[model samples]
Target: MALMTTDTRYTKVAIALHWAIAALILCNLALGFFMEGFEQPLRGFVIQTHISSGITVLLLSIVRIVWRLTHRPPPFAPGTRGWEKGLAHLVHFLLYVAMVLMPLSGWALISANPPPPPPGQIEAAPAPVPGGAAPAAAAPKARRGGPTKLWWVIPWPKIGPIQRMGTTPQGIAEQKLLHDTLVERHMQIAWIIIALLVLHVGGALKHQFVDGQAEFARMGIGRGRRAPR
Candidate 1:
């Protein structure tokens, strides 16, 4: 791997976090779509994974933002255009917005819905049957949405009264409405993020190949060539 000189490249930590978050976002996007066809157990598992990955992206983004504030990005490659630079900055700003909003919206949506039981706790036993040998299973209830345990291991703290609002008919109906509205917003923003990513990557590749700039290298991806001053 050819590394750019420190003067012309991102710090290793920034590069690492950049790629890691990119991979996680891409993976979660795919999983979100993929879960549509899955059945109960598998769907539940995939949704949990998507939520966990998204939350991880949110946390990493926070750290990356801090790193960015303290550290200057590598200087632009030689001959980069004013319009191109403006567009790049715009895309980056939108990306940060999406990164911050996507996960928060998802978490909020989950919080607004009914929460699931804390990790590792067995669901309450079904009420006893009136006269049969086997106890009747409680009627399957609609998922109002709720606190999601991360990686099926770490418990996210219960967030709001919304989680506790599902016990009554009116509350359940209200929670479901909130859940649907949030899901729509979350998905719309996710798509916008993906579109911004396409533009961001397309611009970088254009610079790398069409413009003969070592743009990839500036992000620690490939070999760098020094431009004459």
Candidate 2:
């Protein structure tokens, strides 16, 4: 009987992107939760570095995803456990979801409740008013493709409680309620994503240190060379 082998190690591109993004997300998560929400003496330097690194990770992730569409990754070993394969897929999918959602949520959360404005500058609406449609006779504008549209979601304004008008008390309350609800939900999702990420890191460590496997190297520096079937 022959022992089975496989080209299971992740590709160099995938490994590099995976580790890079993972490190960025982990740092950002800590900065977001520990410093800001935790009420620590807000260090401007930490947050600036976090934001800059996160943007780099996101850009690289996009390129990696595009590369993946073009170049297929190696397959796992035949003897590999099913649960692990499933978990691996789940981890990756969750990562992508969290990566995209966290930033968007951050943006939305910031828009809803931003830092104090410069003295004199008036805080305005929750979101921007949508541009009015052109005359009926005018041709519709060309639709831009991909996640670009997702980011450009109807421009919302950045306003605060100061802008609330006494005349529209009911409307104001409703909008406030909606904004609070969204902000709360976004935060909850972020926490859940963070928990999952902790688990993910733990699992990788377990595979690397406890099991004495080469998983981390395969993902981090792309060292492992999976054998041809």
Candidate 3:
């Protein structure tokens, strides 16, 4: 069993991961909202950045989970009610679920409906012949649905089964339906994460300001106070 500690603040590693993940989540959320306004290459770049951030979050979250399992966090501040503790735990659990599922559902959506060819991949039409008759245009390169690069660096493969879904006409229809469903789920989970964040931050502020507890200090943000008995 992990040692139960009376330590007032989170360990350095935990504190680092917490802030890093929070920053990435906020940035990715902004990217998701604004990406549509961008044109071609720029839009693609934004999307690649978002995907890279999401994958990073997933990896860091796994590390955080392992760290949590092995290291006991400080107990609740004194004067905390039983209901408050229960709500805190529930909100935390849901947040974890949202973080993991949001990226995965996005991955599935893209796999089912691969993005269009990136800039410079599509061939241009052949110039008009001497008689003012246009020769046959070259066939555009096949859309193989290539892997998404992490921040335009490391290659990240899509989910194979979903990536291969729309080869045939019948399969195309099925893939479209699946893609639509995943899109809806992905948006739904984003909203859930937002709501949970509000509750989590609100509770922390309440403890710190309203109840006179050193809440931020427990997360390694500020100076510690004596735990209420």
Among the numbered candidates, top lDDT falls to 1
The local distance difference test score of each candidate is 0.77, 0.54, 0.76
Model 1, range 1-229, lDDT digits (tens) per residue? 2232266778778899899999999998899777899999888889889989999999999998988888878778779889998999999989988988999888877776544556795444333323423432331354535446888889876457766654444455555556668899999998999899899999988998999888898777877764223
Q: Using lDDT as the measure, name the better of candidate 1 and candidate 3.
A: 1
Indicate which candidate wins on TM-score: 3
Tens-place lDDT per residue, model 2, 1-229, is 1122235565556766777877777777677666665333345456545545655665777877776677665565355578977987898677777776666555443343233335796533232213522212211121101121222343333334422321132333334444456668767867878778777878777776776667665554445654454
Q: Which stretches of model 3 miss by more than 4 angstroms?
A: 1-6, 114-144, 225-229
Q: Which ten residues in a row have the lowest lDDT in candidate 2?
A: 138-147
Supply the global lDDT for candidate 2.
Answer: 0.54
* Number of backbone collisions per candidate: 6, 5, 0
Question: What TM value does model 1 have?
Answer: 0.81
Tens digits of per-residue lDDT for model 3 on 1-229? 1123345777677788889988999998889888989998898789889989998898888888888889878888889999999999999888877878888887788787533445776533334334433333332233335578887788887887886655444444456567768978988888888999999999999999999998998777878954333
Q: Candidate 2 regions off by >4 Å?
A: 1-8, 37-50, 113-179, 209-213, 221-223, 226-229
Q: What's model 3's lDDT at 44?
A: 76
